[model samples]
Target: MPTMTAAQRRDLAKQEFDAFLADCPSRLVLDRISDKWVTLVIASLADGPLRFSELSRQLAGVSQKMLTQTLRTLERDGLVTRTVTASVPVRVDYALTDLGVSLQDTVRHLKTWAESHVPQVREAQEAYDRRAGQEVGA
Candidate 1:
């Protein structure tokens, strides 16, 4: 049997930490779009830009506060563009940038993967809950 010295253990830990940090995608694109809501917002903009109200209506169950925060983050990341129009009143529209457009394929691939695994994942969840003696809910 082999044992690790203190120096060896510290080196290994530092190496693992560095690897983890290196593997993490930069905050530029992923920081905001990593969340489901932000990803969906970007996907919705694929067809075309949408007004704030339009987006709110399309994304059901999303509170106005969350939508606003998501939009702001997306804009900061340059994944979404915001424009203001002065008509009879004022209007705001959001559209995806070229960078954001590139994310569509990645998101689509993820969707496909999840859809394929839905049954397996649900069964696993049920099994885990049963093992834990948790109710499946009414």
Candidate 2:
């Protein structure tokens, strides 16, 4: 087989996004998606669009600043949409975009899996700690 030129290689790389590559742009997307706030926000929005206060109330312990930042990042990434309506009090709502909807199920499953496996994870951590302690003692 013939080898491609540097320009050809660069073109191919541009056509495909590989997260495993150190410099691939997909890593930035992965980093955003992997954030705990992103996961929770995606999962929360899966139900339906919610006002800012509602989303914050649903996600306990997430400070207002953090939530705002997460929503802005998500919006910039095209994973979520923000709608503003004029009312007695200016109203703003957050909803998942088509892309965000596609991602929500996967995030939901991950959240559910973590919640379901907490006991097993704790056991594994305990066992590892015990082994480490014994090694130190030895």
Candidate 3:
């Protein structure tokens, strides 16, 4: 048997990569990218790199442990890079990779949609609650 080249290996991997499959590796990638922290972190880094403290401040409500975990996951997935600076306090920065940047526009659109549709969503929820109440009475 002949050993496959790098290109051949990549082709084979791509051929077998299917997100719809329960055990497919691509499904894990999808799960990671779909996480709320992942979305926020990626979107926050869209402009440029930010230190851990800065990111925590910008994200508002993210705990330090959660941020650290999300960053580690992003780094593991090759979506973000972590850099350490030789400063007085030793600053660590996180920045999106090219692959991460490719997702920025889509994430931004999702963010925008959520923000703009809140009122409509609230109205829908109220209507749903009223209907549920009527059904309970009936």
Candidate 4:
């Protein structure tokens, strides 16, 4: 039997990933990236590297624990890089890797879509609530 090169093996693995399948590994990755915190973190790091404090400030409402988890997950996924500087305060900075940078535009678009369509979504939700209330009262 012939041996497959690294590229060939990677290609084969890529072909095996089907996000539609419930058990597909891609689904896990999709779930991670689809998280609001992940989206915000990626978008925030799009411009340049940011220290932990800066990230927390930029992503208001994200708890310290949640932000820490999100950064760890992003780092594990190869999307972000964490650099710890040997300074007085031991500064830690989070920056997007090339892979993360590649996703910046997509994440930005998702954020934009949510922001731009909030009014329509709110109207839809109000209509749904009214219908639900009427059904319950009927």
Residues 48-70, candidate 4: write the lDDT tens digits. 99999999999999999999999
Q: Better model by lDDT, 2 or 3?
A: 2
Q: After superposition, how far is residue 137 of candidate 4 from its true place, in Å?
A: 0.9
Per-residue lDDT for 63 in model 1? Answer: 96
The lDDT per prediction is 0.82, 0.95, 0.92, 0.95
lDDT of 2 at 113: 99
- For 88-113, candidate 3 gives per-residue lDDT tens digits of 98989899999999999999998889
Q: Candidates' TM-scores? A: 0.73, 0.88, 0.83, 0.88
The residue-by-residue lDDT of candidate 2 on 1-138, one tens digit each, is 789999999988775797777888888988999999999999999989999999999999999999999999999999999999999799999999999999988999999999999999999999999999999999
Q: lDDT, candidate 4, residue 100?
A: 97
Please write out the lDDT profile of model 1 over residues 38-80, one tens digit for every residue. Answer: 8778777889899999999999989999999999988887788
Error of 2 at 60 (Å): 0.9
Clashing pairs in 3: none
Off by over 4 Å in 4: 1-15
lDDT minimum window of 10 residues, candidate 1: 24-33
Q: Whole-model lDDT, candidate 2? A: 0.95
